[model samples]
Target chain A: AQSVAQPEDQVNVAEGNPLTVKCTYSVSGNPYLFWYVQYPNRGLQFLLKYITGDNLVKGSYGFEAEFNKSQTSFHLKKPSALVSDSALYFCAVRDRYYGNNRLAFGKGNQVVVIP
Target chain B: DAGITQSPRYKITETGRQVTLMCHQTWSHSYMFWYRQDLGHGLRLIYYSAAADITDKGEVPDGYVVSRSKTENFPLTLESATRSQTSVYFCASSESSVETQYFGPGTRLLVL
Candidate 1:
């Protein structure tokens, strides 16, 4: 079985400061990881994904994530945070070698960007 | 307009009522998925369809039924609504099993 863990319940960061959200995973084989953001009363929007190439992958709205094979972690990052970036973020993972196509999602981290 | 859509956006029903949530996409994606989101659990897949008429169960599927008669539409039905079944339901579609999935606006259901 594949699973993802986002240890933090809430992440607070000041505007213009670097922000990070941690995620760790347990899967049978290589993993396909993804990050999504949800605004109030809105559906989740895809942020970024890490499939097979470089460890650092850039995504929408100036967000990026680093995939560390040694750490078994994929953490989302932003160089500078904005107040508008405050929202609920989720990390999901799927086994690459497994054909089930089911993704295991973390409980989610609520980001609060303070101005 | 041109993306995935779910209806009705908000619904209120009583226990034991049967309700159906509709999803439609225009991308012609081959895979469709239904997920329920709650406070602690981010999102739990109820069912997924690889193509028209091809469906499978996911993490949580006991209380829901899904059907895809056409490529653009997938509807989830709750045979007997329960208070525990109240959640925000989201419909998503991807070009294939490995592709990025696009989600709909979601339907908020309340069962009293």
Candidate 2:
């Protein structure tokens, strides 16, 4: 079964500081991973995705993720955090069984950027 | 609401009642999905369709019903709404199985 894990329930970081939200995945073959952010009373917005090629993939709003196959991790990172960046983050991986593209999401990580 | 839209952004119903959440996508994507968002569960897929008339169950499919006769619309119906079903429901679509999904505003449902 393909799955994803976001160990941290909450991460608090000061504004302008670098931020890192950890995520790990378990899949049989090359996994298709995605990161999304959701604000209050809103839907999830696509941030970035790691399908293949480069290990470091850049995405919307100056966000990026690193895919490490050995570690089975694809962690979301930002050089500088902002108060507006605070939101609920989710990590998802496509289920490999039966060649299904359905995603399996983690418990989600709440990021708080203090001003 | 050009991209994707959900009707009755907020809804309240009673247990044992039938409730349908509407979802519409403009992209005419080949795939559509319905997921429930809970406090600790994040988003759990309820059902998904590869194309019109090709619906399939997802991880948590019990107690839910869906039909996709049209490509642009995929509505979810809770046969008998339960308090446990109270949560935010999201609709998403993608051009293909391997494409990045685009989400709708979501419908917040409360079963009293």
- Judge the docking of candidate 1 as incorrect, acceptable, medium or high: high
lDDT of 1 at B57: 99
For DockQ, the strongest prediction is 2
lDDT of each prediction vs. the true structure?
0.95, 0.93
Kindly report which residue pairs in candidate 1 clash with one another: none
Worst 10 residues of 2 chain A by lDDT: A94-103
TM-scores of the candidates, chain A only: 0.98, 0.96
Q: Which ten residues in a row have the lowest lDDT in candidate 1 chain B?
A: B1-10
Q: What DockQ does model 1 achieve? A: 0.81
Residues A1-111 of candidate 1: C-alpha lDDT, one tens digit per residue: 899999999999999999999999999999999999999999889999998999999999999999999999999999999999999999999999884988788999999
lDDT of 2 at B38: 96
DockQ of 2: 0.88
In model 1, what is the error at residue A58, expressed in angstroms?
Answer: 0.6
